[model samples]
Target: MSELLAIAGLDCSYGEVQVLHGIGLALAKGEVLCLLGRNGAGKTTTLKAIMGLIPATAGSIRLNGRELTGLPAHEVPKAGVAYVPQGRRLFAEMTVAENIEIGLMARGKGKATRDMVLGLFPRLAERLNQRSGTLSGGEQQMLAMARALCLEPEVLLLDEPTEGLMPSMIEKIRETVSKLRGLGVSTILVEQRVEAVLAVADRVAFIENGRNRETMTAAALRADPAAVKRYVGVG
Candidate 1:
């Protein structure tokens, strides 16, 4: 139960426009830690900082006690972190298999790793030859997640994963997250749905106005649904 990914006093910005201020998070191995806040509350910025996609001007991001603050964005995955951004970014013209192959390139994963991740999303398996851009919204999300899993990451950063998905797709995404937990993959989940947040989060941290607000056990938060709305911006 040791911390696998840790972020302390994180600060991020876009050309001097700071979006995060002293954000901190700790994700233990095999645990799901959710980040809650309103739009533009620095939730996604925290995740990007952790992934090295956005530079952190101040703070520490460590994985397994190893410093990751200055690691290159491309090297972050090799260091055991995989990120699935909110948009499901994939090569529009690439086949599903090709997209996954690109993910495999991060850590030099091969057929076994490819097959394992593909197994997680059988729909993606069925569409291995299909172009990613032509897939449905839900399927694109699946591919994005499967692609990240190809890195066999110790920590997974999921940003609004269930957004715009159907009920069935949302359930599938939740099921996949549960499976990842069983597989000992820690996750930092940024979600919009209160039910989904409760379903997967072992703990929830509130980020407010670009700073660390507080953290609580999911059970504690679930007992107070009104607080859940207030904290996560459910309105």
Candidate 2:
């Protein structure tokens, strides 16, 4: 359970307005860590900062002990970090295969990479030539995840991936996260659903008002609903 990604005393801002203040969390190799907080708690900001989409004003972000604070956004994926942001940003005009190819380009990957990615998401396999915009919401999410997985990333940052999906689709995402963990892909998930997040997370970090409130094992959080109420007023 070595630390694969670490954030210490992290801070971020939007123009002159600060959003994150000394937020800290860590993810172990092959673990699923979920971030839980009320809206505007800077959970998404933490993920973006780690991806270098929004630069960290101060503090440390490291992957396998290599500093990532100053790295360019494009280089972040090359450093083995792939991000699936809140929106499923897809090229509406592109086909399913084309969308995945964009991710392959990140690592100079070829057909073998495509095959493996398709293997993980067989539904996508059936719609390779279909335009991404025409797919269902669940299908779009699969494509977004497939695109990120094409990078063969060690750390996957997922922002509210299950939002607005049906229960069955939600289960599909949960299963995919579990499957990825078995493959040694550590995930930092930003999710608000208490039951769903608890089901997949190895650990959970509570972020309140742009700072770390506490972090505990998922089992501990499940057994103690009061902690959720204290921080987010939800179970």
lDDT (C-alpha, whole model) for all candidates: 0.90, 0.93
Ten-residue region with minimum lDDT total, candidate 2: 226-235
How far out, in Å, is residue 122 in model 2?
0.3
Candidate 1 — which residues are off by over 4 angstroms?
none
lDDT (0-100) at residue 99 of candidate 2? Answer: 99
TM-score of candidate 1 versus the correct structure, residues matched by position = 0.96
Per-model TM values vs. the true structure: 0.96, 0.98
lDDT tens digits, residues 1-235, model 2?
6799989999999999999999888898899999988999999999999999998999999999999998999999999999999888999899999999999999888899899889989999999999999999999999999999999999999999999999999999999999999999999999998998889999999999899999999999978989988888775
Instruction: Summarize candidate 1's per-residue lDDT along 1-235 as a digit string, tens digits.
Output: 5778888888899996988988878889899998889898888988888888899999999899999999998888999999999898899899999999999998998999988997899899899899999999999999999999999999999999999999999999999999999999999999978889888899999888898888899999867767766766564
Winning model by TM-score? 2
Q: State the displacement of the C-alpha of residue 35, model 1, in Å, after optimal TM-score superposition.
A: 0.8
